[model samples]
Target: MTSHPVRPVADLFAADGRLKAIPRRPARREALLAHLAETLFEAGRTYREAEVNEALTSVHEDFPALRRYLVVGGFLARTKDGAAYRRQQRPTGTGGAIPAVA
Candidate 1:
């Protein structure tokens, strides 16, 4: 199986592990959103808006933007009423390894 390229998280965070700032580049921002979604939430667990805010704020002060990005990036799904959120499953690659070429 081929593995996906992992985005580097080292430069995006400070010594305390808080994000230095929300990334302006789309790729970088998407990586950040995925990291936040995976680390801050559990799959199949529903979180209220306040709970999400609290978890996000522990890492960065701008919780709203992070929340919006997570939803927009399809990393986190929200209820129609905007009352709850869940972490979507990480996308998988191809089911099996490719055969080696001679």
Candidate 2:
């Protein structure tokens, strides 16, 4: 099977700044999630689940999936009770760069 090119994060969105689509490939999705985590959540601040949903919904209608992906992708962390959320300082093993999709 052939691999897909890694599109720039900007290309994932429409001219209006909303995400046009969520990527399916792991590397591409990681890049998008990292971008979203950085832009949407402030560092060193805790957020309510409703707040996270609001922020995510501003970008995409499917906030729940985005929320799930963010958590699963390690971009966002939530309390055991699921009432709170916070952006992780950084995703592990990224070396502060988005890995290329290959």
Candidate 3:
């Protein structure tokens, strides 16, 4: 598959890692959210819903939306009962750069 090009996260987020605004382009949005997901979660680890929310809250005030973006962007996996969450082994994203924000 030809990977979609992505702009730097600075083009999307504020200095604090909060999304300044959602990108209109799907490719850029997915790339930016996928980068955000990796920063908030770790490989080989699982999280409870509350834990995921707490972590996402540090990055954005609208944690639920952020969580949905992460899952929908194929960067995170969640259980059907919504009890568990984890970074997926292989995100079906365009494989873009990880953001530099903390």
Write out the backbone clash pairs for model 2: none
Q: lDDT: which candidate is best?
A: 2
Deviation of model 3 at 65, angstroms? 1.2
TM-score of each: 0.79, 0.83, 0.74
The best candidate in terms of TM-score: 2
> Which structure is stronger by lDDT: 2 or 3?
2
- Give the runs in model 1 whose Cα sits over 4 Å from its true position: 1-7, 90-102
> Which sections of candidate 3 miss by over 4 Å?
1-5, 91-102
For residues 1-102, could you state the per-residue lDDT of candidate 2 as single tens digits?
A: 898778789988998889888888888989999999999999878899999999999899999999998877668878877888888866477544422111
What lDDT score belongs to each candidate, Candidate 1 first? Answer: 0.78, 0.83, 0.73
Model 3: worst 10 consecutive residues (lDDT sum): 93-102
Q: Between prediction 1 and prediction 3, which has the larger lDDT?
A: 1
Model 1 root mean square deviation, Cα atoms: 10.0
Misplaced by over 4 Å in model 2 are 1-5, 91-102
